[model samples]
Target: MGTREIGLPQRVPGTGLPARVTIWEVGPRDGLQNEKAIVPVAVKLEFLDRLAEAGLTTLEATSFVSPKWVPQLADAEELLAGLNKREGVRYPVLVPNERGLKRALEAGCPDIAIFGSATETFAQRNLNSGLEKQFEMFEPVLAGANGLNVRAYLSMCFGDPWEGPVPAEQVVRVGKRLLELGCTQLSLGDTIGVATVGQVEGLLAAFADAGVPADKLAVHFHDTYGQALANTVAALRCGVSTVDSSAGGLGGCPYAESATGNLATEDLLWTLEGLGIEHGVDLDALVKTSAWMAEQLGRPSPSRVVRALAG
Candidate 1:
């Protein structure tokens, strides 16, 4: 093989992967929320614009949670108000509860996501509610959505630090409940990111067996164990077309300190490109954007692709 060819994987076509994938970019929201210092609303707006210009269609904008809980996202309203939302680009916000839902409605958000926990300990810790009670809490938020698009995030799907190895059965049970609560899509999260490719395939199989189609699911993987990309490919092979990624691998679960380093958007894009899948993201543009964000955060990006390409 030529030197350039040796450096790149073959552009294989139609290896049973989805023809198109929707990347749910979570930089401005998930990435920035974990920052020690609160990012300015103007900076967030600029970040969103950069992401949109880089051809990412969906960007998680901000969360409407209690300011005291996640102080970094306290400027959600201001961020949305100042946002120059692009046509055909979606900027969904996270709504943690009924009060959050009300604020999201007032902000004129077209799409929103709710966070759910698969394990009881995480549920109690994150939402301050029991496993079953968390569903009760989500009922009103889903009810008040008024036909707007709603996505649900089920955390600790793979493993939890407090509770070891989550069962696929448990994950499916919580996922179906979330879907039943009017969530259009359910994102399975590896909160502590301990999933291997085998575990990923097995969980997808369990979900399929439970009558939940892959189209209704998205996968949010952290790279704590260096398995995020592997898990993603397994999910993609199982027909999951939507994925959740953070730009520059910037954030993890604040409540779960062990959940570090979300799957980077640039890395996913690189893999998609090599596989000849259509994602429509401008890798160079996105790399530059992440570089800018890293500079703002006063650190280098954790994304391998960003480090390699933008250096």
Candidate 2:
């Protein structure tokens, strides 16, 4: 079949896609947090600057978690302080709990993100708590994010390495609770990248049934199983407009042994362009940024778009 037959919008004269997709770039925080080698603060700042120059409006800057856990982001405060803070660009930092939130506030962070897991094992492994205890932990943090733009991430929504397929109902319940706790947005995560188009559709259907508007949700997919782009298409068709991706396909869950790099922002942008989607990102600039970041990491980018553009 053709692209038109699949119901995706075609490009119009002097205009982009019918829908304007928001690409939430997570390379700075989620992408680099797992690296064993520490990246210099100057290099990190340069990377952030490059992304901004590429027209990425929303970027995950850094995590205010304990230095002992994620030493890579230990310079969170310094990074935030040194950032150019471009106008019209949002830099959201990840805060694990009230303590992290306090640190973020002290650092003058205007936006924060909290992470929750949908399944028991992942909850314990990532947050070091049972399901209910995890929510208890988030209560104070959410309560503290009064004047900030808060985003909640629900990981392992599709499938868990420890426990196979997760039920869509469970994800909806957790997502609803997060929204009730005052999270302005919820990003459903396929942490292991095992989600299929059917699973994405089913999960969105469940969210709709639970009164969670598509506007209130974003999708985070890893490219581990090579299904991230397909799942993203499924999500867009279901009315989801925001997506989380890492430049150069950087990032892997430190807790999930089977997890791989996130969906590449450049690849996602390519797909968006093909669908005539209106995202203000500069694809060539994004590719150049990813290629430079790969050099900093002493390797080539895993992103297909970067490779193709580089060639």
Candidate 3:
């Protein structure tokens, strides 16, 4: 939304990767929310179209949270209503509570992701309730979603903004609770982007030790410290496949200071290619789409790969 800032591109860490990796694009909801200017629904639709054309199958379209909380996505209903659902591509909305869930369901979002913070402070700040109380809030929504066969996602599994370096045990504990609460997939979010490879390993190891299956976890990292892709490699090495990212390297939590975009989809795809990991995405297409969205938003991309390529 301003003048461009040129930067160096960083190579992803780790070794020969898997054949394919799934990219869960969150740009529509997460990316736009951080912009000072409200993005038009037409622009949002165009952005989503480009992403789907680039071979992205899963996307977080919008959040059903109160407009008072996230004015950027206040048009959540209209946005969802206008989306031209592409076959095989799953568009999920972030339903914050029962009310939000109702709106998403009414808007006909077949898939949804319910958010619950791992730390009490974040839960209170974001959800207006304590950790235990947040679960209570999710109970009915989870039950309703389970009945309707909707998906759920939990956030802040790595580190919290209010609380420093969340304990590995706590991560496992919260993860299990969400899994038990009927979350189809649990995304371990590095909310403040303070996670390291070793920390990711330990966190996943703790989950493994807790008898939670590896197939149920997703890794969501922010590139605030330029370590998201590195941490993602670590998770992949640990056999965790599902990764949450945003195109053009967009998004950061409002509550988290200095937090940057979620891991760039372009950067992630490049890493997957280097590792022999398979992701159904087209790297060149992703770069083009990223540039288009950045142009629409009137801002330069936060993605290192995009910057390097454009430069």
RMSD of each: 3.5, 5.1, 3.5
Question: Can you give the TM-score per candidate against the true fold?
Answer: 0.95, 0.93, 0.92
Worst 10 residues of 3 by lDDT: 1-10
Off by over 4 Å in 1: 1-10, 254-260
Candidate 3 structure quality by residue, lDDT tens digits, 263-299: 8888887777766676888777778888888888777
Error of 1 at 284 (Å): 0.6
Residues 144-257 of candidate 1: C-alpha lDDT, one tens digit per residue: 999989999999999988889999999999999999888999999988888899999999999999999999999999998788998999999999999999988989765455
Each model's lDDT: 0.89, 0.88, 0.81
Candidate 1 matches the true fold with a TM-score of 0.95
Q: State which candidate has the highest TM-score.
A: 1
Candidate 3 residue runs with Cα over 4 Å from true position: 1-17, 146-152, 255-257
Better of 1 and 2 by TM-score: 1
Ranking by TM-score: 1, 2, 3
What candidate 2 gets wrong by more than 4 Å, as runs, is 1-18, 254-259
